[model samples]
Target: MTTTNDTRGVASQELFERCTQIRQLLAAGNANFHAIGVQYNLIVDTRLAEKAGFKNAPEFLTQQIKELSRSTLVTYGAVARAFSAEVCSQYGVSLLNQLIVYVEAAGVELDANDPSTMLISVPGADGELEEKFFGECTVVDLRKAIQRLRRPTSSAPLPAEVDARAQQCSAALTGYFPQQTGVRVEVRNRKGKAVMSLKDVPLEQMEQIAALLSTALRSSRAA
Candidate 1:
């Protein structure tokens, strides 16, 4: 696959404008879920061009874009579509917000003009570190918070309140696995990379939590 770096002129402008517009739409809750899907298909056109040796050809880019699935296309047609419509839908809004707030509150702002970014560490079910994002947040502090929240207590099952909050933390990981359709309650290792335990819980609970995650990721990206 040949990737073109010449995203100058109209292509760049189109991407930027589309991204800005999508942000405005989503912030106002005016986003058409189906349309987002359509955009996704169009955005994937670049890949098609690369494979077809047409990466530098705008004609091929436009032509390939016309062939994507209408439903999923909108979700990736532009920068905003890819992040907002697709990534956010998969991740969740509230989770993203917490990330943004967590980072901002920690005073880890990024230089818009620079490529360098910040990193934050969140804990997984097995008390292992999961690198969350590069933002304006303190990685050490976030890791500390996740560690404090996930550690099993001796007296009880980590307390009812603690369990609930910890579950919220787990829900943030829905972005990592698309096959996770059901709710999972027990702590597990990230993608089962290590010897982590898995527990299956009520399906309804998982769906609800996943919804929150999707919303969070979307909103956080926008913020």
Candidate 2:
């Protein structure tokens, strides 16, 4: 049960609050993101949409919540299921979304008491890889971390010469890509069902990368 302590900050001399923004705002313009998300969960969970003569959530979205995109509703429920109001406000909408994605994709929970085990490679001050938690990392760092985690795990070792040649090719290609492109190329070479993926990249950046790929493929012989 949520006691007075939970809302007032500090778990009644027990736990410390990491996120202090506790006021729940449900006003249309105010957007207490996660709290609104909680309402979303309830609506879907209780079949309120069905009662409203909608075939499904998508229909409900199209008919009533014209402004709410399908993607927003999906992620909103995820955010609501994942964290409390305070954590949602503290992390902000983007981070909370990333948090859910990380946990689901990595198959691990975010344990506040044991953030050490959650350690992953993140860029340090000197621009070198350092292990850190999501809370400790900047937004850019978290994005990089999620990308690293989602990358396919190699099942077998490549021959030394092939690996070296690939590294050189990668370096060359990396140098050619402009930093402003906001595009990334990933090679998910691994045994089994591993597939390439792009996470959280904007559509404009994706279109840029797609254009590059189209140009490259046009010149190359059919693979």
Candidate 3:
């Protein structure tokens, strides 16, 4: 994978141990992402990379934080910023992130503490909508749930050609980003739909991806 390296850096066992803590804790299961975020925040906030002679956090993270991808590190920060340490203590980090996405995308008012039910104000939703708790929602389940919410208003089902084309586009994105994690691309037959999820992409690459999409949209309009 192509990593953006910081200017020359010296190795520090202390920093290495700090980075390694993320891996070690996660492996033990039930990792508290907020705690991991604290360490990630420290490294970035204090510019710990420079202490090791590296120019930026990306370089330090990529080189020093081995095995774990940049996306995983970013999730630590997301969970820390989005939820309390107490809230995140029991929830898996991915679940927390997905819930945030679901709320934002679905316009659903949710109590993170009570995942079993939520009050979503959509076209026909009335009062508190009794729903399954989301602790077990896989990424694919997330996409389907979102789609179902908008089903009445959603456009026609994705044509097979479009689905195939979208798959190709997703593959191209993977080829280009290479190091990204937790990406999901699915073509559901029953719904004749395709969903491509790109989450936890590193901050540095986000602008590039956004710009690429914007440019494509412009060209499409012009054409």
RMSD of each: 19.7, 14.2, 14.5
Compare the candidates by TM-score and give the number of the best one: 2
- Candidate 2 structure quality by residue, lDDT tens digits, 1-223: 9665354343212111111111123234445777657666766775654544446554555454456677876777787777777766666777667765666677776753333346557655665778776667566767776776777667666655544444444444445566675545454457433234444456656576566545544444232
| Model 3, C-alpha of 183: deviation from truth (Å) | 30
lDDT of 2: 0.56
lDDT of 3 by residue, 9-103 (tens): 33355566777886676666656568877777777887776666667665677675575578877877877777778778766677777777778
After TM-score superposition, the amount by which residue 166's alpha carbon in candidate 3 deviates from its true location, in angstroms, is 23
Whole-model Cα lDDT per candidate? 0.44, 0.56, 0.63
Tens digits of per-residue lDDT for model 1, 1-223: 3235444444555554544444444456534543443443443544433333445323433353443343223323332332344444543333333444444555666332221244566666786866655444344545465445455444423544444444554556544345555534345333222122335545556676567656655655554
Predicted structure 3, TM vs. truth: 0.46
Those runs of model 3 whose alpha carbons end farther than 4 Å from true positions after fitting are 1-17, 23-27, 50-52, 107-117, 120-140, 147-223
Candidate 1 stretches with Cα past 4 Å from truth are 1-7, 47-223
- Per-candidate clashes come to 34, 0, 0
Position 78, candidate 3: lDDT: 70
